[model samples]
Target: MAPMSLQDLVASLPTGETWGPAASEEKTLNGVPYAPFSKGDKLGRMADWTAEGRDKERGGRQQYTRNYRDQIYGAGTQTGFEIQQTEENTFSLVDNTRTTKTRGFGRGGGTVFRGRGQRGAQTQRGGRGTFQRVGGRGGQQGYDSRGGRGGGRGGRRFGWKDYDKPQRNRDASVVAKPDWKLLEEIDFARLMKLNLETSEGEDIDNYGFLYYYDRTFDKQPGAPTSQRKLNIIERAAYNVTTSDDPVIQELAEKDEATIFATDNILSMLMCAPRSVYSWDLVINRQGNKIYIDKRDGSNLDMVTVNENAAEAPMETTESTKDAINSPQALMMEATRINYMFPNQTVVESETSKREMQNPHPFYNPAEESDPPASKSYKYRRFDLSLEKDDEPLHLIVRTELDAVVKNNINGDDQYLTIKALNEFDNKAQGSGGALDWRTKLASQRGAVVATEMKNNSCKLARWTVQSILANADLMKLGFVSRTNPKSPDSHVILGVLGYKPREFAAQMNLNLANGWGIVRTIADICLQKPEGKYVLVKDPNKPVLRLYEVPQSTFEEDGEDMSVARTGDDDDE
Candidate 1:
């Protein structure tokens, strides 16, 4: 061959020839498809120096990163080219080094103490101390930075190790026998999302009489002039359950409504999502009617104190040293206060009392020693039917009014529902970070009420719901405090505050439609099943409601047993 210039060599080459291999029509080479890659992709290194020893140090986390990195370079399409290792080709390396057993807590050889102090401290016995951190710096004094004893002054007090606190396993109001079958379990989250619009409901009938509310208690709270010693009033008051009431039974016979409930039980169900304590209601479904009733000496009858608090009053079994602040004791004290408050706060004069449509249905003057308390029971019916329903769903609730007050704007008689909130000891362990009511109740009245709303959310919500259900013009909340923090027997009325029922509901963010939805949903559940006795129980620890299809003799035996006990006690006396 003869030597040629660069231009002559280029001209002598083939027209479509190039310096690289010839372009092929087939997209595969050696039966392997070409892996599509972007022009902006960076070439990966065959061996990564920085990645060495990192996989072992990071417990093989680097392998995940390597796989992810490979995916960025179109490794997904190159799977066919990957080598398949067989059992023969794979070899395992076994270490001959002897492993020594170590004594330690958890993973490391150091004990872990959780709290606000030195994480791993040594005990006096030369062993690691896993004692929970007490409070304050260096765990010196029994104080915590987050409002424990002698710390975080003026700040809200939080329970120590709330997460580690023992679960409050409260006993249900009625025991579920082995024969009772669980029908449904609904969570509060689901209940909260349900909503149904309902009407204000019609007044079916009215019973009992109410006295005029004495306006003297409405003076400024915590004032020496306004404070009055809560007197023990002898009055015959009745809390007849739905099925026990003769009027309700008569209405049920007349087919007035599909559901029957009292204000107390209905309020509890409507505000179930706000409740923290364990409560149960008896659901007796007969033919086409559902009656919501409570047992005698039920917790539902008694008002709860701080039942919705983050750290509610504990039982003696829950390591609560203070018996006066226990849940049972507080409930008794609150119930007593609620029972005596309305009677004493009203002017019980025949001339000033407001008569209802009928006289007291359950009271008999010849059989009772004391007169009837100032109360009025109004039977109201609400429509819970949706647009798609064939038949209208109605609920009749026996609502109550404590007293009748004359409106200031118009002299018309305004119905009132009075409820008292009792205070035990603000400085007690489970006081729910309450302020000193005697001091703050006057100057910081809003703060006191706000704190109460936070602590007693369920109780207050129930009261509000009851007030609304009764169509009361005003809701009176009396603040009653113990004469001695150490003694719950003696209490003095601090003051009384008045709020419109609807306005109060608005303040609490309580939606009547949502409550109606919950009630309707529960009613529909029972209506779907056959005629049987059902028990609706609020879960103690969890925000859940469970419906149990109990036997016919479930609560009947309980009542009989209680009656026998009472008779025996009376005979012994």
Candidate 2:
């Protein structure tokens, strides 16, 4: 090929290769130091891509939306009043059937008088003194139903009428949890079930059980009455805390066999939404606790988790020969996880593999692992399944503040929207028969964002919805370590902490286990650096992505691995 003259170059140039003289430069979000756009970012550069109901949204053939946020699929515009009215009507029917029985038992001479002292023999009236007895008298037959509204000295049992509007105000309080009822029934019930498992356990397990209480429900203003405490997921057989620390904590750990590149990235993102805007985690000084809420301000309950939540295998661990997996999903194995506090780090191991003389029927982990060393129980789980098996592009993010967790008018709508994506999405199918079950289960919990095709040569481009709870700190309950061990991908978690699971796990010598582990409140966030390049990530606080600290990134760069040049922070050992 010969070089052409400047005049000849213009003549042979391809069409639509350049902007015309009339084209004026428009500011983009890609400029350095400061991003041109934020939460409500708007721009002509990517407007069409950002528009609703469009393909090329995060490389999908469908539109990107908080699809679950609408009435058709979302929480809908339904009110708690409607639920209450329904509940009341149902309760009324039940009340009618049992009103005479329940109210009478509380009021009349039967159990009431028996408690009052058997009409002068020996019992204290233990109920609120409000009864009306009008039967069994005149001494015609002394064997008649001999009892009066006896406990008329006990306190009045407060009913719905007793609660007033002023008493339900959250004006002076902080909503640490969401109304569990407002969430999808299955999701809420699952959380409650986990709470019960822990609470009902003996020994040190209760604290682990109690740790998930904050996630149990949203604690609405009045509808589904709740104790006005820091709204826990489940109450213990005793509302007991062995330590004065107030909140109880637990943890689960495992190392993914992160030998390859793809596995590494997927492992990181699955932990939580790695978006910069999502870094705002909740830190409550009073409870000495923290919670991760999506941008919409609701708890990130880790519903992707299953029974034995910390023992599930992840894609990376199972896909690799030397992989380690979390033991969350295998019910065959019994596992438990907990933490060594103050230091807030982790250590994991296996327990007895032999069965006892008599076994209490449950998913027994002990008897299954013949030699304990032969144990292998981890089922991989993915929160989102794709229509296409191709790789899903993810953008990590980081933020400066941790958002608060609570319930409010705006927060409720946001919760419904998120649930529509999370809980409902998993159950929704775009088109199908029972075979499309997986397709319909369409849950997505990230926020929608956009990107371009290239620097200058572009039409409408790609977009995505990122998650606010990436790299979360999780506390998985029901992890029984005595039998089943944890896998590398932990499904049960207290919730997410803002830190990469890989780097943080390494620092703690972490190995995913069926039992508990706590990552001493680590915090940070991830996000794309310099925009459209979509390759670089920056965490001002975390050094994992810092060029200076990780001189040679362990992550794959094209065909090369950055591991050789990788180093911890120079400031660190």
Candidate 3:
């Protein structure tokens, strides 16, 4: 066959043929079925893929006869060389023999192999910069430049261990023995004799006052029981007069003591003022008018309690006579006591419009004092009772103390000072004001309330019975209602008030203990309910406190299933 040159091969190929052999159905130039390019294709139409076919023949097949030796030797040249595997190619053998001779070396010099073996080639690990060498066949060894082994030279594989272990907590269960026995262990009779008093001459103990009453009043022959009741009433008045607790101070300032209990139980009650007074009520019967005094200024006829009672006796209305005679009627007068000063109240409608734009009068306390505790501490008692029970179970009677000493004092200023001290939890710095001065303002307010209570004590006492029976909780707490044969619904609980503790003991009535029990039951329900810890409902905007004393049974029944739900076997895990 003639030698085919590159030009001859190109000229003999089909024009339309692709780089690879055409599809199985494609036609060849000389009647062959499989061709490198399609029949009708033009030259230079092949893509980069066609360039790869240059290494093969026109038919998309390699020249099998053209081996490396044949190509190197070419057609006529003959080179005698046989391809054979050498000993190095057959296997990698372990050589135990090692050379020990040195060739002009100092630090690089060594005593040769420690063991008789050829060391494997040292391989440098990428990025680690550390080298490791295989000993003979399987033996391997490496060392860190910093005299450490393993992970990467001197580096360590750091990790958190036992991070999931539970933490230890301090035990808070240590009971210490007291140096002296508790007060409960001592006979209350002997302890009552201690009669401790502060250096300032104020009684430091509640029992001290009781002790004084017992020694001086009770021991006296034919002393009226009224004398003992007077002492308790005085102590309560004292608390209103001097207590830092706002509730007590408010009662003193307002001259009122709220009776929070019913006739059935007279041992305990949360008492305070019926309403805080912003202005003093001064009735000018001579002028036939009632005047409201803001202390700084006064207004005439703020209310028409009586139109012409002062002008003519026959002109006085029945309502006017009733209002003049009652303390509750006086309390009702408090409703119109405006916080606005005399100047603000006098502002004309046109002037008020301009003032409203500025609003300085409203915001400035000096110009406008806060309305006398608008929702009276009296309102709080009702709210508390209503929240816990469907209706008020007891009467918050407005009462006055008997023969209380009146000392001139500013109730508001004193209350403010007391409040500041309480906020910082501080005691009075020096001698407190004289008891006379301390109690004077409260006494005046208290007297008004007391006079009202005194006139209506009989009627109020009856109302108290109805109130006690109405309260289911008070009834459950052993406050029994006795029915009267004459009045269908009316009843009486004897000795609810005015009975002395000594009288109870001497008569063996045990009434004092029963009274004490009622108090304890109330305290427990208020403080120890399991549903949550005890907390006072406080609204800073409202100065009054709403308090309730729930019965123990009531609180437990509220969460009756709690104890049962908490029961089960302990889990060691």
Candidate 4:
């Protein structure tokens, strides 16, 4: 065949062709089923994939006679190479030969629980909780490219290894897991409370029990216990002056937990703030009105709760109470808190959005502004940077912290800066804020999300959940799975992206290469077996090879089976 133009070559192109070398640079051609061109992914030359380059045509229809001896067919011919490396540089990844070392989750060697070890030291009993560990290696600052926050062995961080391009090797992908609280994994009741109560049911006003004589909590709430879990509440904020009656003032300042538990009305008067909230009932100081802040140029409201109420933790809410009395209000606030908790009852609340954490969007700070922490320890948080995908997809990456390193100078200031999210569990005790933040993150299609500056860097870890969960295809293809209950599996979240993968994910395992799959060893790929065995779904052109890596199971220990199916044990040879 004569030398063909790019257009002619693409025109003659067979289906399932991987356009490349210069294809990504071409942007778009007349009409071709071309893969989304990414300069990062390796793409070989288009011409080399043709029958003109090799003998026997590589297994009938299989492309890429990737063999080097066929660089030129016969003599006096031009070199046909798919991958072009200019005089500049090229990157390649080399894997560790020790395949036996790769085990799933806890049983895997050389893998360490990077955040958990740090938490044990900070706590009273010297630490037994793995989820509570904070910070990464290299001082308390894990973000620094240097030492202290990474590498259990104290060398450079070890990640996907590379050959040739040293710069690309240094470009390590740090996959941080979500900081899953030890609380209820699925929150089945809460899920029912929101969906059935709000989405499918009538707007049942004032359904939850109103406490007139309940008591507030005293000890810290770490995990979910029948008696220990915090309750979400709707309350009224009040302002009492020098001329006011003692009865109202006492009730206004009292803690919800104290009033509900002990019913000691005089000692602890729990005021009812007609605000939509969860966890703590925010008591806005009397005379406080709706006001706007310059941030984001959006109308914002602060509780302006009495400095005395600062003794009790208060959260902020973004739910608006306007026109709840009107039918249009129902349509306007469909997906947000309005679905369940609507209307901040106070009439003035219509002017501004109520400020308190509840159901979906909630935030309970480690320490209140002017008040000391209710407990002895200071607040800790994490900061991270995520690679922005073109679209939101379900994604989950779990890396056990090698060990946690912590330093608490005083009760007011504590530092636990580390890798991943679970470590931030103890300090960031607001599951409400986490759920809200996750929703916000999922809204951003493709954005590199990072937490604000704080000692601990990986608080909530909800963004990680959003990343993997939204990308249903990737998650179903065995790319991500939850390491904890808060992350049970991608099933529910993937449903958000309109995907169901219960069957496919269950069928294949990376441990067995008999079926069609992708890069088995980061090396060879088998498109189709000669005898016509199994094929990969949605990827008819590409072969799916089995991977031999099986994660270690906590199932037997948890009284649950591996659930991961065993491959038929087909031999590659």
Predicted structure with the largest lDDT when compared to the true one = 1
Per-model C-alpha lDDT, please? 0.77, 0.20, 0.22, 0.20
TM-score of each: 0.74, 0.16, 0.16, 0.16
| Model 2 misplacement above 4 A | 1-267, 271-351, 354-536, 539-567
Tens-digit lDDT track of model 1 for 352-455: 88999999989999999998899899999999988899999899999999999887887999999999988899888778778888888899999899889878
Supply candidate 4's per-residue lDDT for 481.
12
TM-score of 2: 0.16
Error of 2 at 266 (Å): 4.0
RMSD for all candidates, in order, please.
14.9, 34.7, 38.4, 29.9
lDDT by residue for model 4 (343-430), tens: 1111222233222121111112343333211111111111111245242211011111111111234423121111111111112222
Q: Which candidate is the best by TM-score?
A: 1
Q: Model 2: C-alpha RMSD to truth?
A: 34.7
Which segments of model 4 are wrong by more than 4 Å?
Answer: 1-97, 101-107, 110-199, 204-573
Off by over 4 Å in 1: 1-159, 318-322, 557-573
